[model samples]
Target: MTKALKASGFLGLAVMMAVGLHQFVILSGGSAVPPWMIGGHAHLGVLSILAIVMGFAVPALGVVGQLRTAVTGLFIAGQWGIPGIVWLGEGFGLTFLMPTGFLWGGALIASMLIMLYKTVTTEEAGGGGRAGVAPADD
Candidate 1:
């Protein structure tokens, strides 16, 4: 289960990086991205993937509770683009931007909140500490 989710998460991050850099190409070149993301794309794609995976998976392993807490922070940080790309369009007269503003942003925030509340406050949260604590605390 965890492995599946991790794989999915990695794949999702990869796709996000690809799409993100592709936007830059589509912006500057004014052409559809071709065989692959290169030139500007290669540099940004790799860097984006590296940063996301490191930030996403570091705390999401072995300890589900910690992962939940970490994900909430990551989810929030990931929204630095929200207002500029999302809210600005929505605030005045651009309703077309509503999807990006509400759908994506809301999903990210909601999922993170659920994961955090479930893990951080659950009974099993502290039990994982019992194995090592009994010896060290005494």
Candidate 2:
């Protein structure tokens, strides 16, 4: 609900999108080369996970209940959606992606992005949100 949280959520969502696209490409017989960069998929996964954790932390500042609910909802959807996607992909002659890695990755990112944006924009009586400092505070 704060700017910082909103930013985190967006960043996380970006990560998720990247990972999902990567998986899709690989499954489509594109190339792991694209996904395998520096830390590679593994790294992306870890960073993305961190983003989610950090995003969750933002709610602690205020409106955490909403974030918790969002995350919980994402979790529930992931539980079924991910596996279902994988199954469908496999059925379509796809391998590599055994499960809906994209869904999980996307959800993580989406959750973080939401928090990050909220954290960055919301104003407070005092102190800066995620957008650095307010002129008044300075």
Candidate 3:
């Protein structure tokens, strides 16, 4: 759990820093900064927050295995690729990148919902409110 939290925290921080740097590029006219890029920028920022939140939630739910793997991959890819495709598109006029980015975004959203559902249900199974600790032996 600690490992997951640290990894997610670090990832979120990195994405946030990248977003900040990209903002400078946009403001300074280094990039053309298309309108859609604004959404991409926003998307990465929001995804970063989601990662951090999930980091905290994971321990409570005792989530592991395939679902964790899927969430981590999708979150990372979405965080990077979502904005990256937009950046690439704006830089080179490659409109094709948007579809791929959207797919990544969709996967991220689905994985997040899965995690949330698992966490909530796991908490219910464990008998209540908070859930960070492992459940007692039956």
Candidate with maximal lDDT: 3
- The superposed Cα distance between candidate 3 and the true structure at residue 99, in angstroms, equals 1.0
Over 1-138, each residue of candidate 3 has an lDDT whose tens digit, in order, gives 436544755776676677678777788986665676566667666766766776766666776788777776766676667777876876568977767966877877877787878866774454555668787899
Top-TM-score structure, candidate number: 3
- How do the predictions measure up, each by TM-score? 0.35, 0.36, 0.67
Q: Report lDDT (Cα) of residue 4, candidate 2.
A: 43
lDDT per model vs. reference: 0.48, 0.53, 0.70
Candidate 2 residue lDDT tens string, 1-115: 3444345445555655676776777768955543223233344444545545555565554545766567545643443345444444444456665455786768856765766
Candidate 3 Cα lDDT to native: 0.70
lDDT of 1 by residue, 16-128 (tens): 57667656768798776542333323433343444355445434533356555455444433333343343345334565655664654564566456655555655553456
Positional deviation of residue 125's Cα in model 2 after best superposition, in angstroms: 5.3
User: What pairs collide in candidate 1?
Assistant: none
User: Candidate 3: lDDT of 102?
Assistant: 69
